[model samples]
Target: MLVFELVCNGTVNDILHGGNKAPLKLDLRLIIAAESAQGLAYLHSQAHMKIWHGSFQPANILLDQNFMPKIAGFGISRLITEDKEHTCNVIGDLSYMDPVYLETGLLTLKSDVYSFGVVILELISRNKPTHSVNNRLVRRFLEVHKEGKKATELFDKEIAVTMADLEILDCLAVIAVECLNLDVDQRPTMTDVAERLLMLNRSRRSQAV
Candidate 1:
């Protein structure tokens, strides 16, 4: 039997739920989100057989001692055999589920993209996607942006002070908006999203240095 090393930092969900001594900082959250996107990019592109992470959520994502993100739980993954319909009715976490996939049984790459968008929202808002009080976070964020509200106000209080780059935050928010588009066909491919995020991450690092 083969064994894998345990990740030290634990799930992103845990850290968000006061698991850590202090709240996660802004740069750290962005880094983790970017890393998670890279992981998804690899899984979507490098595999000989396409694997759909069926369930991509903060709880399903793990972090290492270095705070690197790793996607786990492939047990529910559906290997795309052909362009045919998959009869499996796998339902992921409700909050992170793609609305299109929820209505239709078809699971596609875009489904993962939608779930990733939710994760991005969570990182920005520091709130759970399924929070009953504010379930339509993405919609509200977009509304607030359109209304000329300060975008930084949407971010968690912990990292509010460090959020100087409103442009970058706006870009990220726009990307998330595209990802969460109601029409799956309108969403950017994981490859495209990964490349864009990689550039963003590099830019952020350069600015930090």
Candidate 2:
């Protein structure tokens, strides 16, 4: 028999959009992104063996009473060595899965980066990955970013209310876009993503003080 500890606060999705009308504040969002990035970074680099989270999505991200997140749904994960992309049957949600993996049927650590990037986008917009014109939160952000513009309209208005908040949101958007690059080689490592997110959180909190 197996057991799982129930997360009191439910998933990040439940907290933010599961019939809860209250706003998901900027501070909490930053904490979630920072902590989640660090957690994934560990699986990618700090773990004794590299682990691929074949199903990294918002729904799998469980939150405790304190709203701290835990990554779940590891039944499909695989172990990999240095710079190797595991080949397996197509798995994971289309909206969050890496396109490269879909196209090549090869999963790399960067594929996880792609999924995390979608999670970051969700944290920013409060929009489900399936929401939007092209049914992809990533495409909208990329289009806006490529035009050298901020996708403020795509953000959760509650969090992006002020100029300061928008600045922080834009920084996150930059990180998400970087993770979402089509060229797997161009994607930053989870280590880099974690550091950037951690630094952003620290910088924002310092300014708020």
Candidate 3:
């Protein structure tokens, strides 16, 4: 028999909008980002076989009563070998697909990193991967970033951000940018991304106290 734990809080996708529920708080968003990054890091590094989550996104991330994130939907993940070239036809939400992967059909660890970057931006902006205002969130984000605009300008209205919290938001934005680099080699590994987020979350909590 198989049993599944009930995720009382629903998914990251739901929490973002929080239709009837309370919108995701900034601190909770940080915690969710850190936990999701750790979940991806484990799948990419510590698993018996390195699993590449070809379809990582907000909807696939389940949240518990305490808002802790658990990554789901491994049914489509690719099990890759160290020496094996893990390449396949592109399959995933187009809004979050890595340009390099979409064009080359070469799925790599960096591809997941790129997708995670989109999720990060989504969490920060409370915008879908492709919004009506901007067809592609990542491209729009990069464009605004290149124009020397602050990440605070893009922050979701529901998330309360004071002057003090801007630095933390900026740090997360920088990490997201690294993950979304067009050049696959420039992206950081999931482990690195996870650790960086964890540290930032801790710092934010410390400052809140």
On lDDT, the candidate that comes out on top is 2
Candidate 2 lDDT over 1-209, as tens digits, reads: 99988799888878767986466799999999899889999998989988888678888889988889999888667444456665657766888888888878787789989999999999989888873336567888999999999889999988888889999999999999999999999999999999999999999989989
Q: Which residue segments of model 2 deviate by more than 4 Å?
A: 1-4, 78-85, 131-134
Model 2 Cα displacement at 101 (Å)?
Answer: 0.5
Over 4 Å off, model 1? 19-21, 79-85, 88-90, 131-134, 145-150
Q: Each candidate's lDDT (Cα)?
A: 0.78, 0.86, 0.82
Best candidate according to TM-score:
2
Candidate 3: Cα lDDT at 112: 86
Candidate 3 least-lDDT 10 residues: 78-87
lDDT of 3 by residue, 1-209 (tens): 99999999899888776677565678888898999999999988998978788778999999887888889986556444456545665567878777777788777778889989999999888888763333467777788788888767787767745866677777888899889998888899999999999999888888889
lDDT of 1: 0.78
- How far does residue 188 in candidate 3 sit from its true spot (Å)? 0.7
Total backbone collisions for each predicted model? 0, 0, 0
TM-score of 1: 0.88
Of the two candidates 2 and 3, the one with more favorable TM-score, higher being better, is 2
lDDT of 1 by residue, 1-209 (tens): 99987898888988887545466777788888788888888887887866788788998889888888889976557454437445357466878887777777777778899999888888877877763434677667767757867567777766666546555676677788789888888999888888888888788788889
Comparing 1 and 2 by TM-score, which wins? 2
